[model samples]
Target: MSATAQALRLWRRAEEDDAWRLLRADNAPFAVAVLAEHLGGDDRRVDADELAEAIDADLDEMRSYGHDLPLNARGYLTAWRTAGLIARRASEGARGETYELTVDALAALRFLDERESPRHAATASRLASLSMQLTQLAIDTDPQAARRLERLRSERDRINAQIASIERGDADDALTGPRALERLRELLSQASEVPDDFSRVRAVFEELSSTLRAKILESDATQRAVLDDVFRGVDLIGDSDAGRSFSAFSSLVLDPALGSAFEEDIRQVLERDFARELTVTQRRRLRGFLDELKIRTAEVHDVITVFARGLRRYVQSQDYQRDRVLRTKLLSAMATAHAAAQTTKPYTPVGIDLELTSVASSSVGALRLHDPSEYDAAADITTHETAAVDWEMLRAFARETEIDFSELTANVNDVLTASELPSVGDILDAHPATQGVASVVGLLSLASEYGTRGDEVEQLTWITPDGIPSSALVSTHRFTERIP
Candidate 1:
């Protein structure tokens, strides 16, 4: 079938499908309301039992409204799945199955629940969007250099006019409160729609995969030819309209600087006076919508990765060889059957049953125990008694070696008060080393704390407690005298 015809058929199916019809049913509003209340938040999927309980609770309140509600939540979900309003898939591990709204279904529900903006329409935002779309379309579709040049010239003229207006003090043309609110609403709406688009793109990719698999299994072509066709089909999918849009969306979402800028802009908007008009829920929704888009983008990428891996495995496995063998066996059997039919009075079809068994059994092996005595060993050891400490000798050693930091600090401070900017040498000259190198280190520490002068280096010579001379290079410092 032609691409146009296929698209038309799909559109017609969407319009006339039982799922679409279900949306028009009286109970649909209630069903959609329940879904929106229970599943419309951050959750992409809900457990069947949890969804049932939620539905039952909603039905309890809804019963007072004299409306009949479907208590069988699972049945309702199955119906919706059959209609393409939602999808049911086996949950991971042992969590049974889960149901999530399909792209079309979500769009439908969002449209139904959409309300008119309380703020005035933003002409600037609308015009800007239209202008951007037109410019992009022109650039993409028109390859003529003359047309491109003309577009550039026109854009320049528009920019010049805006600049002139600004210079003329026509700042009144700036966005007003209502218009800003409208623009904010527009941005929120666009962001909210991104997740649905990702869901649609994922669906398209999955459909493409299914088509490729079917072709591989049914085609009479050689394995190489089939593999080539599969690759070409995959490329075609990646270049499709949905694929291109999703790729662009992913790039935008993943760009750190752009994401940060967008978040900052949203924060700025939220702090505006007009933002007070928005309810807390609305504010949170606007703020969180971008994060949700990022999550959806990640999910789409994950799906693509999984699909690529599965496709790679399918190609590498070379199942076509087994398929050929099976075909040959079937042909041989048919020929044998024909020969037997010619000789026998009557021929009857016989069934064969094959029993398959695992190569390994599920029995556990015996555990081995180690003897403690084999690992345990005792070795001869020498022991020393605790030595008695000489308290007087330790006191003498500490008194001879101990450097007083407080006395060093007082001496350094005295030198700084006497000199406008003192070097390490000057501090040493003012106070001769009593503790030797240790006192020099204390002076350097004090100079560092006082702040260094402009690239001035100083050499300091000090004697150790044992009378050995040591020299060190230190940055000269300018110290301001502390006020009383």
Candidate 2:
């Protein structure tokens, strides 16, 4: 394309792009700040309610500072969603929804991060890394055997010379402090892009999945072929270009030797005196980089697997055909309506009154059982004079019916004060259940509020009211610190 044409194309694309739109939005600073604060770092996704609560606090703070943010957090979030900056998804195996930054929003955030912490374009470390990568690429891709061999021999000679110099006690060959910091910063900057890259990869798989489903829906021939492949146990999504690329990335991230080396390097770097100059966040990211990468890689793999299986199941079932039929009926109705609109006035009422579909009517047997006490009232309800309160009797009644959570709380706090994380069983062991199973239930409730749950179940033993030993297997829970 010519320069003007190419420039015009790029300008149109920029106008349409969500990242570009986010950067140039009216409340760009406010939006970006809120999004980065909530969705950045390890908390890449925040629960919908939690995100709203956090942003609501931020809005209040900004409003106190004389900003004109009239809408609440949910309202702003909805607007941002419409603008394609944020996305909401159902949380895995959890109630309610979660909000995450869209791929474009992640890109914009990354851009802002890089802009804030500017890296020199031509730093020595960057240049050296690029040069080394290019040299390796050249050596690996060279077609001529002689040229490749020559490059290999030259590399071997350089390594041998380095070994000889190191053997001569050339400790001065180590990188200077400044140079090492520069390299470390460069590595971190590069590492920062990885999260965005993973987001993009996931987006690509999602798009590819949609495209495949669209193809199936649009073409009967393609549907048959896809079904045949699926029945043969072929993974169409995994065999795609995006899938292959992610597969390679997953393999690299999961590699044991590479992981070990990366971890060791991080440990060595952290131990260096120069590392003290690095921020806590930088140090933490470096330490957890490999493990996080593996986790993200596995998550992406699961996404691919889920999409593939869902697509196959969609095709194998009659859902698509039913949907196709529904689509046809809706379109036909639209056409009929259009035709009628040409002849009849829009305000004119039709003869028919449409009723919406609803649940089937059932007898009162499905309703709650009626209680005479709930509705009954005495014909003459005489009021009596007030009397002195019976505190001891009230206490006896409460002790008989209530769970005695105050006692349970004391038990839990006593156990937690001694142990960093104590389970329900631990609390019971430390303080036997005074209220029998009621105390156990109360302890579990307290644990649910303040403790972390484990996968394994543990048997909680307690003495019954009659002094018989009672036990029940319950999911393990651990508490940290005293529950004040």
Candidate 3:
């Protein structure tokens, strides 16, 4: 492509990409500060409400410092979510939803983080790490067994020499001062990218799954091959580039030996004298690096698993067929409309009237501002002398509310003596509900625990304390004997 063509493509991408859009936003600095303060550290996700409250407080603080933030936390969050900088999802067993930074937003945050403290392009620790990886890759990939054996022998000899020197107390602590810090920074820099990688992998899987669904809904002919492959247990997603890469990464993360060694090395590094020079955040991050990697890796693994299963379920349930039909009808309608537009203006009145679906929308200016004073109660209280406790009145009140279980048990037993497996209605008929519905309710409660209930319902009638007749259809319960 020509330079102009390439530049146009780059411009288009920048316009579409969320990370670029976030960076180019008017309040980019404000958004970045809030996001990093709340969710940029150990917390990958925060409760939606909690994040809004936290951001609201920060907004107040920033506004006090002469920042031009007019909107509240919820307003900013809504905008950011709509713009795809932040994502919200329902978490399991949580009271409300949670918000997390999307992969693109993470990328934006990472860009800003690096800009503040840029990594050297060719630092000694970075170069040495790269060199060691390249050497290992070359040795491992060597076609000739003899060459691989020779490389392994050389590595073993070097290790032996190092051991001999260490045994003779001639080895020096070269990684003590500045060198240790450099390597630590390099490690931290690399570790910082892992979370973004996991997020990217999850995003790729989601997009892939969506693409597969779209393909499935294209047409019957297109779906046949896809359905056949799916039915035959072909792991289309797990076999994909992103899926395979994540699987390998997860395996490494889950490896017991690798995890143990990584943890031990981190501990030893943190205990070193050079670690004292590191900031508290850096030290904390280093200590939890392995744990954080495992968590992120597992999250990616879960996303892949969930998406794969959902895709399979989507296919098996034949939901795509309905979607395909809907799509076809929509296209047909659109085609008809397009043809009609050629003959008549859109505003031209026609004999046929179409009802379109719509949502309720209103102007923000129409909303009424809440006045707390309007709802506040400001009545003064008047003190009165305490009345003497009336024991008889209290007992009468308790009798009215409390269920008379003994009377209900006796009624059940009396009814049972006359007939075996007497239903609740039979017992109520024998004892005319002296306590009205309360007595009936007491009997039903006892029957539920000590007797059997049937699907059949019977209308039981009773007179209330005010002599008003009342009736209700309740499930039939039979008692075989007197309540114990």
Say which candidate scores most in lDDT. Answer: 2
Considering lDDT, which of the candidate structures 1 and 2 is the better prediction for this target?
2
Per-residue alpha-carbon lDDT of candidate 1 for residues 282-338, written as tens digits (9 for 90 to 100): 898888877887887877877776776576557544565576668779889999978
Roughly what TM-score does model 2 have, to 2 decimal places?
Answer: 0.70
lDDT of 2 by residue, 1-484 (tens): 9999999998998889999999998889999999998997787878999999999999999999898987999999999999899888889869999988899999899899879977786889999999999999999999999999999999999999899888898846688598999999999888988887888888999898888777666666324565445533568999998888888878988989998988998899899989999999999998998888988898898899899888877865547778778777998999999999999998898789878797555987667767889888868799999999899999977665556767877878777667778899988898998877767866776676688888999999999879999999989988865677
Kindly list the per-residue Cα lDDT of model 3 for residues 8-89, writing each as its tens digit. 9999999899999999999899999888878777888899989989998898889899989989999999999999998898
Task: Work out how many backbone clashes candidate 1 has.
Answer: 0
Listed per candidate, the RMSD to the true structure in angstroms reads 25.2, 20.9, 16.1
TM-score of each: 0.57, 0.70, 0.70
Residue 445 C-alpha lDDT in model 1? 50
